[model samples]
Target chain A: MKRRTFLITTTAALAAASIPVARYYSNGKKNYPPLIMPEELGNFCEEKVIREIGDQYRKQVPQESEKAKLQQILLTDDAGKLTAVSDNAAIAALLDKKIQDDFNSSRILVLSGWVISVTEARQCALFSLT
Target chain B: MHIDARQLDNQSVIEGDICIIGAGAAGISMALDLENSAHKVILLEGGGMEYDDRVQELYNGKLTGHPYYPMKASRLHYFGGSTGHWGGMCSTFDEIDFEKRDWVENSGWPITLKDISPFYPKAHEILDLGAFEWGAEYWVKQNNALKLLPLDDNIIWSKMWHFSPPTRFGTKYKDAVVNAKNIHLYTYANVVDIVATDNVASIKQVTIKNYAGKEHTVKAKKFVLACCSIQTSRLLLASNKQAPHGLGNDNDLVGRYFMEHAELKTGEMWLNHTEPLSFYLMGDKTKVRAELAISPQKQKELGILNATVSLMPLAMSKNTIPSIKIWSQDDPRKALDTFHKYSNLDKRNYIQKLFSKGFYQSYGLYTRSEQLPNPDSRVVLSEEKDELGVPRANLHWALSPIDKKTVYTINKVLGQQIGAARLGRVKLYDFLLNDDPQLPDYTSGGWHHMGTTRMHEDPKKGVVDANCRIHGIDNLYVAGSSCYTTGGAVNPTLTLVAISLRLSDHLKKTM
Candidate 1:
């Protein structure tokens, strides 16, 4: 087979493996490059201890404006089908929801408003002026 | 002179007690080991000092790999070698890394971690770290500012990375090494070939050349190839006068098993949850190391053989780009320089805020997976030779499917756990995500390379033996990651240093 054709087929197979059954081939719209490449992520996540969520995007900010930006990083959701986060309110609310969810998950926490993470002791924290 | 000296026209006339080739990490380390030993040592480095302008001319706008000016010392020449510009983050190999795994094909080391424990302390000393310690205890005394992840069940954990104080080997150890009585480090000296007397059984003498087109040779009782992985293997493959192929390419394993950490472009990761921020285990956390941890047992359960994931802060919560923040925030290139200018508390406070304000500079966990030995990833002899006329090595590397899978699993687990624990939101990132394993991710090729010319109980599987001696060859040994059979979840430098120190002990014992 031609290299290009082979690549196209393999790419399709990979895309299928990554996205959940709920996701589908778009009507030829722009696709976000899958951020996570194929290197083994880590086997630890497979432990029954932590549950897996099919829908990667979970929004806590019931707000509309920030939800678009949250989806921008969290999911590609049918591309043009979903409204993009175009407003500052959406970005702020979306950031807040994401932070709150991680915080609830214990991925984020506060002490004197100074954030702390459980991943690596010395590193891994987002800095912001609230 | 400690420098290997002999007429190029008559290699048979060369003489020295010890002849070392490929003056990179391993070579230099061993050279440092033998500095004042009883024997006279001759060192032949393949590359010249201070970045050969002539060789730089050859790179001549041919920017092909990783987009880094392409004209870099993927192997450096000269006195101090590649350590000339290294971001020194050091860690030792875990004991589990030495065990043979039924899961990973050809995954096991001839030597166990215990065998090298004695040398770990010394290796740390050479790298100038505080001591042989890791995990939580190290953090407690420092300050419990950072939140620690629980990765190990029994042992407490703390992770500390050291900056080299801009450790340039030339400036750091130049006077001592060059002026030492027993050590002679030659500049502009390059090893072009390694030939044997009869049956590729022994390397009789090595041919050397300088940029001036002057060729020379050196002979010794024992020869240790210390150059980095590519050059060491390249020299071996290029020397095939008596052998059908080359010196140690008998099993066609001279340049096989090429491995490097494949860095992925993690696209925008959104956290439906807020990412945790920590400052407890900042600089002085060496007291209580257990507070910090990585999920290892979780890794074993997941069928992920060799990989790791660290939470890297994106430019901002909204902008998920990993590296851009360094640039977007007040010009990162000048940030370090700026940090040096001000020693005041205000400057310190400003730097801290800068560090906190929307960008974090760090590495994800090393996918310390083994580079499955593949003949395809082999480094070949390039037509463009170094200044020494020795054939330059053209590396042809392509990540196989297995490589992609290994990367995918590592990120999934780490991202999920970090996200599950609410550490931060991780955007999925596989090494092949961008379809460019060789893309300009700041973390690829991780100068932490290992595996080529690996060690094995059998000669067929490896170029060197347990003691790093090349099997069948009476007095040949290698020092560096090239001798590593199974590289574990730690820096190869510390482990390779451990192995070299063992080589150093063996050399002293035998001598």
Candidate 2:
């Protein structure tokens, strides 16, 4: 085979493989970044528990406008693709600080009888969309 | 010697150096303190050694305002008073409870916690509690298994509580009181009237009567009303022939400022992981447990009343009913049986089974918070008279906006602390989510009647003085929670006994 043709074919295959991976890591939305990473929740992020919390979050915050405002507060990067390449450690730290600040500032809501921080509620709100 | 007033001849006059009316925690504590003293003490009890329906009927009356436990059911008319059914939870008032906060009107007490600290050890002995120590560190150090949550001490801390074997005063001190040489206990002797001099400057004597168709007079150098708050105020208000407005009602402050510890289930705590909250759990073998209390500084900053938050297993707590709902019968015995049937006592085995499995991921939060003293919440004389011809008491229990605020803020603060520690989450009940000043129908009292004849240095401001003496009258005093200037978040038994002992000392010095 010709070297030029083989090189071009290999690069195209690699690019196609990376596209699905990026989609899997996104918030399952068309233009939004992930609000919370699964690893950030530590042992609390069981699939069943997340779905239960997501269900409750939807019940508490039914309005789309409110959900959009929460998403904006959680994801500061308007350049959506830049957030996809953002450092995982920095995102986790920022999320933790936001949860603590929500508590300090009294920005809290009760979902399924569990008093939770708005940051965590926003995460559940985003997860409910998927 | 003990005398059954029912056996005495009609119009017989009983004489003594001092006469104490009523035989409850306060009366008995004072009598016990004066045991074998030089002065002869005459102790009067309205009922016999056991519960009597006829005597209990005397306490029946109307509820004018807020929903409350029936007056007949809330108190006992027998020798031991309400101690027969008390749950035996005891804790001292915080320093903030005594101070006059700018936010809480009519708040400060003439006496501080320092004045009452000396008598608490003795009160502890009377209540069958151990070691006078209430600090959480002291209790936690003794038991290594009890671990505290990793919350900031500045925002929230553990407030320790000591449980009693629940000494029934009737059964515990009946022999001691009846056998004392200087203490003359007259059972079935209910005070009917308080007679005073022409100028009404001093009490001449009190008339006594019983269902045995007998009436008599009792004369003493000094008279002390040691009945529980309602009865004390009732007796003072009924004795109106001499003063026209009752014995100490010149300023019309006799039956005012009624208060109680507002108790209710506020919220739930959802732990991130199952926690061994041994320090917060109360078991049969556990003598001391801790509740989460807001710091004084935090309360001042928030402009809220002092409050304490208790945690329980949600599995059992969710099934339990409120005490006010269960204790609805007019008869004390029936009400108690109904309460036991529906209360957490019925789920003992279930709770034990749950406890054996260790902790759970979910818990329920209950609050016992203070109520601001309100003049409108009071006890007044009802027009309906009992068989003994004395007017029955009518209670108007009114709670304030600060009370609901206190409970709501307590649960909210606890939620914040738990979140900050990463321990768990808290979901408040629907009632606390609103800004409405009206408390929910589920709100209940601790069955602690206090502040009808409140103490103040000035006559116009209170019914009694700092020494518990009636402001305008000499040698006439009140001795019970009725003399309390303000009710704290804890139960009233221990503090009532302590203050009664203090009054005993004062009377002895004057003699």
Q: Score the docking of each candidate (DockQ).
A: 0.03, 0.09
What lDDT score is found at residue B74 in candidate 2? 91
Alpha carbon lDDT of each predicted model: 0.51, 0.79
**Residue-level lDDT tens digits of model 2 in A4-105:** 122223222333333211111123323334464323232333444555666776676676325566556566542442232355555656677778877777
Q: What is the lDDT of residue B154 in candidate 2?
A: 79
Measured against the true structure, the TM-scores of the candidates, in listed sequence, are 0.67, 0.87
Model 1 DockQ reads 0.03
The complex in candidate 2 yields a DockQ of 0.09
- Positional deviation of residue B240's Cα in model 2 after best superposition, in angstroms: 0.7
What CAPRI class is candidate 1? incorrect
- What would the TM-score be for candidate 1 when compared with the true structure? 0.67
Candidate 2's iRMSD = 28.3
Chain A TM-score per model, please list them.
Answer: 0.24, 0.52
With candidate 1 superimposed using the best TM-score fit, by how many Å does residue A62's alpha carbon deviate from the native?
26
